[model samples]
Target: MTELNILHHSSYPPESNGHGGSKRTAQVLELLVTNGYDYTSVDFDTIKALKTLKWQKKVSLFLGTLLRFPFKGKNISFKRLKRVDRLKFISKAFIAELSSIPDIYIWESTLDIHQFIAAELKAKGSKIIGIAHNLESLVPCASQFGAIVHHKSPINRFAQELETLSICDEIFVISREEQWLLNLFNIGAKYLPYYPIIETRNNLLEIRKRRALRQKNNEFLILGTVLNPPTLNGTIELIKMVSEVSPANAIIHIVGYGTERLKPHLTGYSQFQLHGGVDRSALEDILAKIDAVVLNQPYTTGSLTRIPEMLIAGIPVICNEAAARSFYNYSGVYLFSNEHELTDFLSNPMDTPLIPKEERVYTDLFIKTLKLAV
Candidate 1:
């Protein structure tokens, strides 16, 4: 592809602060460049929990959490602004980043409320595409935006949501699961595997293997995010169970940079390692070495890129019951719900598991969509 000005839109600061979507957004940015697309990303940070009215302070605080939000925080929007005020805040962001407009505008939306900007960009003769991570209705109750979107009355803003959804040129679905989800809204979409995919390589496999062997302690490793309201605290729960067995060689590696809520088990465990606020390469290298990647949360429609990363790295994944339902071919993947199931896998590790390297499948389709939109 020729030099394309791709405007990557996000709901969080694309910096070192701990946010999963933002981290995934950054990874995709590198992948876009590697794929020969000259791109510039525009992040419209959500303003739900964020209170700093100052622009410089808002950006600075967000960058601090960059190290561990994806896996650690249950709700990433805690640091952002409230919903009713979000668009107004984003209006400031639009004005801030307005000086630079690109050839294509790709928005990775967590909510339809942000869809208005994409539709507007498309109206301005730019290609617009969005990867919806969560259904807006579900988000209202499950998200910090829930009350804001439907504060006292869901009846009021229902019309605005529809108006926003109608304007986008094309909305991309992350998987067949998400495609089916879009049906509920009657939105047309293209299902590209890992809609915003991060690059995976075999070399990562070697790095993982070597890292595993380097550890004199032979215990299975555990690491991932633990969110607030304890919705996605599976990783913390798993550690509690694993520590019960008292394995001598095992270690728990946490990249948790989310809310500073403390778990009791973290206090006394000698094997538990908290590597927070590290750069991407350092984090990636560490992930390359772990015995098995952990996805402790229940299933959602959004595609999990780490699944591909773990698969391509030949690392087995210990996913819970919820994640197992959405993923396929468990020959190399391990599923667990309790302590007994996890302890059993720690003793017998799998060698070289399968991870789908489905880059080309989407590249062809994504380019076609861009062509049509442009």
Candidate 2:
């Protein structure tokens, strides 16, 4: 078979597992590479120096920012102007780097920046495939959970999202809820749920075996990058819940980047161990020792990627309704809406049934969707 030249673009390095978005992009790339596709991955920095902005565009952006200052505040207006300029630069760089029009162009995330690049690629007759990590417009919903979300206009944001997504030939959504919403807007969207890569799956199984050998220590793990506003807010709320319920003999293990921000709140709690960001090996070691994983997200715009990881590892997941949106029916998932319920689950944890490795069919489906799209 003749190799098809494909171009994959992302804002972040797909190889990095620092966050959910990167992990998802890595997974998609893994599928494409293993399926025998000739692909080139490009990020913002890849062609940064190849493109330069004209003085007219710069002046226009400055004037626009100045005009919005009184209405949107100086900081927000300037930030918006800066973001627009960056996107414009990236789009120009992307087009300049293209030696020839690719057979397929896969852009990660339907953010305005990616959309700008997608529009440029589409004009060149390349099949545009967009990966929508989340409905960007719904991100402001985080504010309900005490997360600070800055947006000039929700209605405008929503319209922009629709416009961006509509330009793509096909969209891969991380959750079914998002797919549904996009379809409502007459966009061609497919649900491609997250699944651990083969290596990660095997490692998780090994961790499960190690966990089974040790006696339960009542150690529960909460995973997320604490630097994220929603995660930080959720972690704080979970801590408050744990303090209120005060589950006996429970040791809450918090792991992720920027967890030290939680230290001030953990002064009196000796049971709380904050392992701020660990290497993969260290994280697997921690996973092997924990009895269960906790997800206490008060509000979520996208499905939590950690849910599938814990479920596949046969580790019990204690989460609330909002956190357990997609995997509610999965075995070993315990839901709690109030302090009393959370206390009961923590005090009397149940054994989680191991999910068979073969049950992970999403990976195949994800690859199939891409194949069909092309």
Candidate 3:
């Protein structure tokens, strides 16, 4: 295959705080490199460096920020800039970088402003691909950007998001479920698995077997950004359920920021330990001690990046029916309908072997889709 030069644009840089979204961005970059594609990563930070006073660029940005202030706290998207203002922002951000145009331009998250840029690049014969991280309409009511729950008329937001996505030459979604959702809106997309993010350690299966034999009860881990509303609620609920069912042992460990809130809920429970966020490297050490990972959220969109990581690592997952419905192919995942089933699984320890074959499947799909786009 011919090596293609690609322009990658995203608000979240891999090194920027270790959130799931940023990690996904970083992992995709790695996949591109391994496949022999030459790509340039440009973020809004570049536009911030561009001359501000030239041709009222600063004024437009200021006005844009002001207009978006109402939605800023809501976390609707990267920057809440109005459509016109955002176009102005991207134009200034990319003017210097686009001097030597690449064959492909990949946008990580879709925003109203991106349409203008995608159109411009398409006119120049560059393949414009948009990676849909999440469906804007499917954001949970508990989320900061939950427009439907907050009376923002999510139908309008959904329509607007779909309209913006229509401009892309090719669409890439994080999960097969998300791709199905997009298809309903007459938008076709290819699935981009996050399996590339999983770091496989040598002798993982043997290590798991040793850990399983040593530990009398299963130790479950709830990882990711615990402070986020959706995560916070789900984690607390699972801990509460586990506490009621298993009072004699400390089995569930919560790791991430905002875990201090768990103090009020876990009054007499010694089994649940809350370790506020640790460094990325430290997280691997923490995972080494645990037997299974927990992902029991009822409502989720896009893809749960953690699922692939846990599956490939040989750690059993105790998730809800919703998650099981989407990721039914994986063998290590355990699904529960209610609190009883979840607690039952926690009481029984099991071995989860690594499915190394998934890497080739994901890599082949990624390369084939990317090559076709070029």
Candidate 4:
């Protein structure tokens, strides 16, 4: 039996659950578990290695030179923590956890943790795999020189990200566009589908049965994070803009965490409703109600996870050009370069049409990815 320990970045606490990362992690675990591949994950508290070394070492942690403390990453606050203490903490916690996991898969759960895991995995002669969804790009889009510093850096936070990519036996990105960029850096990679939750619903048949019940119509819609807060600038600014331009009866539902921000400002807005952070079941059920999806995140290269969910649910999607390049929304996604194009598409959205839903499959790509690392 081949045991695979995944060093994943967990957005939500393990028990609290309901986080996208939790969903993703659970899905990967399900695939591996159902297929009989051994798997396990680390809890946030298990990150105590960071707590111990950060305060004690006073020097940066992990990898030969790249995992330095107080890294000047795109997030300025993290830059303040960029001290040797924080780096040491992160390195210790990360390395210790990686020590426990068996055969490893370094998924895009966090940009911060990847390097530490990669460093150890390489040293142990263990199989190491890297998975990248758009989460890797969110932090980069917020600051000045964000892209330049992170992607094309001589001395930057992404040095760790870059190091991890170099160290990992194989790197996997969600989009063809991301894979294209990695190739430029001489990093070999493959493309894979990003998912919302670990497909635990054993009711795949029931899921399709329900979706079939919904009215599959012509005119589509654009909805997203009415529940989750916009961690990336492209998404926040996008919501404000879309609300102003979309049609009177646009059938849009902005679902996720930070609806309160929009609620105070856009009161009584017709055509859309912000359902802040609903239960996962409620969120999943609503997909049938939406005509399409839109993610205007301008910063990153690959597409967001929501885009993938919309596609699997059989909805057409609208997105900025950067987003279009990131995910392979093939039959559904209508791509745009700037606000004007986005507005033009919103005004006249016959550009791209929706497609039928397909029962999603993932393990094959994952197994292949792991093999590359091995």
Candidate 5:
């Protein structure tokens, strides 16, 4: 059989599971390799390259900013120049690794930088497939205390996102809502549910057995980087609800990168424990001890991977409607619309049986989508 030449690109290396974005990218890469596709991977060293502004780039950026000030105002001009530099760098990085353009190019994320690279690759006669982890435009604006969070203006972000997606031959979205939104814009999008890297059936059964044994004190888990706006917002709301409703014996464990930043908000809540950025083994150990996971996101954007991860582990997930958007039908997921509802569920949490089915459904769907797109 002749191998299909596929190229995957992302801002972060697919092997890195330090964050949700990387984990999602890794899942796609794994699927490609497992399906026997001959693929090339290119990633922008986000931390070392794209994020860092060297003196030379700074000077170029300043000059470029001044040059475009007459046409686009200083602030917009500066943002545009910086974006161009990042896009140029990404295109150059991918080209340096390319011996020949692959038959298909799959770029990750909805960021303008990735779109720019995708457009460039498409120009070179390669089929372009975009993996939109989240529609950045749909992510709600956030604020801390009284200060507005710094980010691209929503209008500009939405415009850029539309332009980026318009160039794609096909797009893979993480949630049904996102797919619907894209369809409204006449963009051909496919809903690809997240495929979590989970333990074997035997291991999951063991986890279910452990979960079935009711402890004297209920333990709940909330997993996400607190630095993220949506998570931070949801966590604060959860803390308030749990504090008011949870019994003195209950414990809420918060784990993820930047969770330590929640210290100030958690001051008087002794029931909440923050475990900042634990490894896979550590997370598994924690999962074994927890009865349920809580996801109280105020607004929906991308599908949260933790939903599937928890369900696959046989752990119950108590989430708000927004957090449970794409996962409504998944086994072991319970949705709450208000604090009263959340309290009721926590008092007598539902049992989440182990999901023994392999992720072949996701794999088959992904392969089918690729074939149609190609």
Candidate 6:
């Protein structure tokens, strides 16, 4: 029996909204648990306790590097703890508890701190599988040279990410675009399709019922996080385009985190409604009233998990060509390029029939992705 050790940054409480990396981490664990993997999950946030605290039972404390420690620890600040000291503590505690490495180790994000630890684990006959959630190499100064392939010297966080991944037996990404970009750098990786959390209570029957109620209004909506530069700038640009072409009667609903940033931009537009972070039930209620959902992420690097969720709602989705990288071939996705194209479609939209809920099988994709990873 092959044992699996899953490593991640933090814990996702059931009620947590789970934005960004947290969401991906939760999804990965859920899939592994659901598929009957004899797995152990080690969260790094609480890993430091393993050092000073004495324990009878073997507790796992695994840390992924990319997780940002914003605040000071109880006794010592994260920055104050030297890297060498931290590494030693983790190494000693892990060896004392586990005695031997597991058959397989699936690391959530590759960080330089993990390289030495992972190398040692590999030596103990463990297969290191890295989930490259985002391409660090493309993150400008933060990562590597980004899209600059012919740079004289490549360095920074991206170098560490590449070095760590190179040591891994296999690598997986959530976006086709990322897979292509990684391949360009001569790195071998597989594209794993993203799977949204589908609940029986909020099933396809309910989604279609919501969509039916929504379609009668013929309203447009663009929703997600606007805190980041890519999403914030993209949402602003999309709004500007819509303002130029959309009819005076058109009602556009903007929801999710950082929507307050859009208030200044929509001064003249009475049709635009901004709903900042709301409860899950309230969000669903808003989605139920939205006719068509627009995804305008021109600078999105990794997979947009929200797209799959929107599709599952049985609503017509209008997004840019670049934003549709993940689902370009999916029959239900509607693609457009510029403001002219989007405005034209909005003016006299064609009949985009609701896709059967059964066809949107996220679990099937998850199963297929897991098989390819191992």
List the RMSD of every prediction in angstroms: 9.1, 4.0, 4.5, 6.2, 4.5, 7.1
Q: Show where candidate 6 strays beyond 4 Å.
A: 1-17, 45-92, 113-116, 139-160, 200-205, 213-216, 350-374
All candidates in order of lDDT, best leading: 2, 5, 3, 6, 1, 4
- Give the higher-lDDT candidate: 4 or 6: 6
Using TM-score, give the best candidate's number: 2
- The digit string of per-residue lDDT tens for model 4 on 181-243 reads 778778887766554443433332344345664553323343444333333455567757777
Tens digits of lDDT, candidate 6, 129-240 = 7776776555423322222222224354455456667877777787878888777767877766665544522563476676663444657888888866667777888888
**Clash number for each model:** 26, 0, 1, 19, 0, 1
Best by lDDT: 2
Candidate 2 per-residue lDDT over residues 71-98, each given as its tens digit: 6553244555566655666676778877
C-alpha lDDT (0 to 100) for residue 31 of candidate 1: 54
Name the better of 5 and 6 by lDDT: 5
- Model 2 misplaced regions, further than 4 Å: 48-79, 141-153, 356-369, 372-374
Q: Give the alpha-carbon lDDT of every model.
A: 0.57, 0.74, 0.68, 0.54, 0.73, 0.63
Worst ten-residue run, lDDT, model 1? 146-155
Candidates 1 and 6: which is better by lDDT? 6
Q: Model 4: number of clashes?
A: 19
Model 5: lDDT equals: 0.73
Instruction: Please provide TM-scores, in order, for all candidate models, with all chains considered together.
Output: 0.68, 0.86, 0.82, 0.67, 0.85, 0.76
Provide the lDDT at 58 for model 2: 73
Candidate order, TM-score descending: 2, 5, 3, 6, 1, 4
What is the C-alpha lDDT profile of model 1 across 1-374, one tens digit per residue?
55666877676654323455665566556556666777666544543334446787556545544543454444334344333335644644573456555667777763555654665566667766766544444322344353223333343344444455456567765566667756566777666554223323445555556655543234344444445323245555666766676357676666655523434558888877766446657766766556666556544435454565566666777777755543566445788777778777666656667545455766677676765665
lDDT at 104 for candidate 1?
A: 79
